[model samples]
Target: MSEPFPTIRRPADRTQMILLFIVLTAGLAAGLAIYSSATSFITFIRTASSALFLPILLSLVLTFLLEPVVSFFERTTGKRTGSIFIVYILCAMLLYLLMQFIIPQWQSAWNSLQADLPRYIKGMTNYIRDLGLKIEAQTPFIDSADLVERGRSLGKDIVNTVIVGTPQSALRLGGLFLMVPLFTFFFLRDGSRILRSCISLAPNRTFEMVHDLSYLITKQLSHFIRGRIIEATIIGIVIFIGLSFTDIRYTGFLAVFAGVTNLIPYIGPLIGMIPGILVALVDLGIGGQFWWIVIVYFLIAQVIIDNFILIPILISRYSNLHPLWVIIAIILGGNAYGILGMVIGVPIVSTLKIIFIEIRQYRRTFSLSERLPESES
Candidate 1:
C-alpha cells in the first residue's frame, strides 16, 4: 500500500501549453488591433461618411430577411441562382412602387405641413397657455410663464428648422439616401458567396465547426429579418386601416412612416409619432373635431402594436438578449462605425455568440479522458 502511494504528477504537455499561450496572445493582439482601428477618428469618419456601403448593408439585410422565401423558391425550382433573381425582382418592384406611389404622397404630406407651419405654431402657443393655466391653478403660487415662453421658443425652433433649415440638412441626408440601397444590392447578391469563401479558409479540423456556426448565424439573421418585416407590414396595414376608418388625412403616408420607423428598436415608435402627430395637428388644427380622436387613435394603435402584435409575434420568437448587452453593443458599434455599426451590432454579436458556443460544444464533445497511473488504479 505504501509502495502504491506514488507521486501524482501533472501532465507536462509543453506543446499544448505553448499552443494555448500562442493562441491567447494572438487573440489579445487581434482584439487590441481591432480596438485601436475602431477608435481611430479618421477610420470612423470614413466609414460613417461612406455612402457606398449603406446600400450594400441594406441589400444584405433584405437578403437575409427574404432568404427563407428564396430558400422556398430554391426548393421548388431546384435552383439557388434563379431564386436569387426572383428575390431581386421582387425587391425592385417594391422599391419602384414606393418611389411611384409612396414617396410622392409622403412628400405632399410633408409639404402641406411645412406650408401650414404658422397655424400649427399658433395652436401650439395656445395649448401651452392652457397648460400654463392648469399648472398655475394646481400650484397656486407657482407661475408657468417661463415654461410657456420656453415652449414657444422650442416651437419656433421646430418650425424654423423644418421649413428653413431643411434644404441645408438635405445635403447630409442625401448621403444615407444614396448609400443604403446601393450597399443593399451588392450585399444581397454576394453575401452567401462571401460566407462560403470565409468558411473555406478555416482550418480543416475547425471547418465543420465554422460551417455549423455560419448556418446558425444565417438562421438567426433570417428569423430576425423575416419576423421584423412581417411585424412592420402588419403594424403598417393595421394603422392605415385604423386611420382610414377614422377619416384621418394622409393615413397611408403616416402608416408608411410608422412602419419604416418601427425598424429601429425601442425609440422607433416615438420617432414615428413625431411626424404623424405633428402632421395631424396641422391638418386638423387645435380645436377641430378630428384632433383628439386622431391622437387617441395613434396612442391606442401604438400600444396594441407594441404590446400585443410586435412583442408577441416578432421579438418573443428570439432569445431574450440582455438589454444591457444590447446597449453596450450599440454604443460600441456607433463609436466604431457610426450608424452602420449601430444597425449591425446586435446581429454581429449574435453571430459571435454562435461561433463561441460552437467552439465550446466542439471541445466538450471531443474531449478525451486522461490515463491513470497503474499504482493508483
Candidate 2:
C-alpha cells in the first residue's frame, strides 16, 4: 500500500539504561540520607541553643515590623543611629503608655477572672445539671448526672493546670521581654551588612539567585509579620469595643486572649470565642438574649470584619496560599510543635514554596536557552 512507511527503529541501549537507572537510584538514596542527617543535626543545634532562640526570633519579628519606620527616619535624618534612636524613643513611649493604661486594665480583668473563676465554675455546673435533667426528661438514654460530674471534673482540672503553669510562664515571658529589645537594636543596625556577608559566601553561578531569593524571602516575611501584628491589634481593639457594650466580665482579658490566639489560622478565631462564650453562658444564662448578642458580635467580628476587610486587605495578597495547603501546614505544624508550630507553619511552607518556584523558574529559563541554541544551530 503506497510502498508503506519504512519501519523506523532505533538501537536499544538497555545496558546503558540499566546503568543510568542504577546511578539515579543510588544518587536519590544518598541524597535522602544526607538530607535526613542534616535535618537531625539542625534540630539538635536548635534544641541545644533553645534559650537563645526565642529572643532572637522575637527580635527578628520586631525588626521586621519596625524596619520601615527606621528606614523613613534614616532617610530624614541621614544617620542610621539617629533613626534607630528616634524609633526607640517612640517605642519606649508606646510601651510606657501601654504599661500605664492597658496593663492596669488587663491586670484588673485578670484578677477579677481569677477571683470569679470558682464561682463561675460552680454556676456552670449547676446550669449543666439543670440542662441535663431537662434533656434526660426528653430522652431516657441521656445521663445528666454523669454529664454534670464530668463537667465539674474538667473545670477543676483546668483551674489546677492554670494555677500550676502561670508562674513559670510569667517568669519566661519577663526574661523574653528584657532580652528582645537588645537583640532588636543590633538586628536593626546590622541587618543589611549581615545579609550582604551571607550572600557573598554563595558561588558565583548562584550569587544572583541567592541574592534574589534572600530579598524576596525577607520582603515576604516582613509583609506577613507586620500585617499579622496590625491585624491582631485591630481585631483586639474591635473585640474590646464590641464586648464593652455587652455584660461580659473580663472583656479586656478576653480580647487580649483572642488577639494572641488569632496568630493561628482557620481555627484561631473559634478558639478565641470559646472563653468568651463560656463566660457569657455562666454569667448570663445560656440561650438568653445577652448570650445570643455575644455570639452575634463574635460572628460579625470574625465573618464580616476579619474575613472580608482585614484578611483581604492585609493577609490574603501576601499569603497567596490555597486553603487546603494552609490547613495541611497547620495540622503538620501543630503535630510537630503544638501551638508554636501552628503559628509558624504557614510562613514556613510559604518560604519553601518561594524557593521551589525560584529554582523551577531558573531551570525553565536554562532549558529554554539551551534549546534556543540547538534550534539556531
lDDT values for all models: 0.68, 0.81
True-vs-predicted CA distance for residue 345, candidate 2, Å: 3.6
For residues 1-377, what per-residue lDDT tens digits would candidate 2 score against the true structure? 47888898877689988999999999999999999999999998878666786688789989999999999999989999899999999999998998998787778777777788888788778878888888899999754568799879988987886778689879989998888998899899999899999999999998998897788667767877888888888888888888887777888777887887776667777788777877887777666646654654467678887888998888746365777888998999889766767877776786677556656766788789989978998
In order of listing, the candidates' clash counts read 9, 0
Candidate 1 per-residue lDDT, tens place, 1-377, comes to 35777688989699989999999999999999988987896677776556445555565666667667777888899877787778778878988987897787778877876877767677767777788888888998874567678778888887887777788668756865666555555555577788899999999998997897678656766766667677777777877776675545767767877777665555556666665566566566555535654554465566766666676767533333456766776788789776557756655665565556556655565463233354368
- In model 1, the Cα lDDT at residue 66 comes to 69
lDDT of 2: 0.81
Clash pairs detected, candidate 2: none
Residue pairs with clashing backbones, model 1: 54-180, 55-179, 55-180, 55-182, 55-183, 55-184, 56-183, 56-184, 59-184
lDDT of 2 at 259: 85
Clashes of 1: 9
